[model samples]
Target: MDFEKLIVWQRSKCLAVDVYRKFARCGDLGFKDQITRSALSVPSNIAEGMERYSDKEKVRFLWIAKASCGELRTQIIIAREIAYIAEPLAEKWITDTRELSKMLCGLINKISD
Candidate 1:
């Protein structure tokens, strides 16, 4: 399956773009780079997994993508706690990340079977 056709991938791509745009004005290079890279990893890993030749390989990459979602969520929460991100946007990002994580679980389960 084409990863682009997957809702999880599409949502993750949107999340990454939103994150990148939101942090564009930030002065903290370290935090910005970390969060943005994690955000981008979600969709990149998804696409790479889908393109893999074997289901096992795909599942491995999907697991990595799933972990990246948690990593991104943690960074986002930290950003909010530091007052770098406002409440509303952080909430939205958290929501999206949670949903994507669930979606990834579902996909992994199906692919594993």
Candidate 2:
């Protein structure tokens, strides 16, 4: 199946775009770059894994993507604590990451089967 057609990939892609848009006007370049990169990694890895020839490779990439979601969630919490992000926005981002991570786990299971 095409990665683009996968709901998890689509959700992750949208989350990455939302993260980029939300951080567009922020002044903290270091934090912004880190968070955006982590956010982008989720969907990028998903796509890369989906294109792989073996299920093992695909699972590996999905695990990476899942880890990226955790990284992104941690960054969001730090951003919120440092006042770089609003509480409500951070909460939403954290929720998104949680859901995305769970979806990644489900996908990984399906591929590993």
Candidate 3:
């Protein structure tokens, strides 16, 4: 599979961009920075893992990316608590994370298969 051409990567890149733009105006620099980092990690790790020559390594990194997704999921909830975005937008982020997680799982299974 051309991992670089994966739709998940494309959506993740978009999610990272959305995250940066969403937090860009926030006064809470510390929280914003951490959230952005977590958001960016999702796609970056996926791409990095996919580029590896080994399925074991790729799956390992995908697991790591899945963990990062969990962290981002938590951060998004907290952000919603602090009113970082509206209910609908925060819910959308949650949904996106869930979908991305599923996609990662599917990729890992494909590697295993």
- The weakest ten consecutive residues by lDDT in model 1 span 1-10
lDDT of model 3, residue 8 = 81
For candidate 3, write residues 1-113 as lDDT tens digits. 67669988888888989999999999998999999999999999999999999999999999998899999999999999988888998999999999999999998999988
Q: Per-residue lDDT for 27-113 in model 1, tens only?
A: 999999999999999999999999999999999999999999999999999999999999999999999999999999999999999
lDDT of predicted model 1: 0.97
Put down candidate 2 lDDT per residue, 1-113, tens digits, no spaces.
89999999999999999999989988889988999999999999999999999999999999999999999999999999999889999999899999999999999999998
Models 1 onward score TM values of: 0.99, 0.97, 0.96
**Best candidate according to lDDT:** 1
Residue 46: error of model 2 in Å? Answer: 0.2
Per-candidate Cα lDDT values, in order, are: 0.97, 0.96, 0.91
Worst 10-residue lDDT window, candidate 3? 1-10
Off by over 4 Å in 3: none
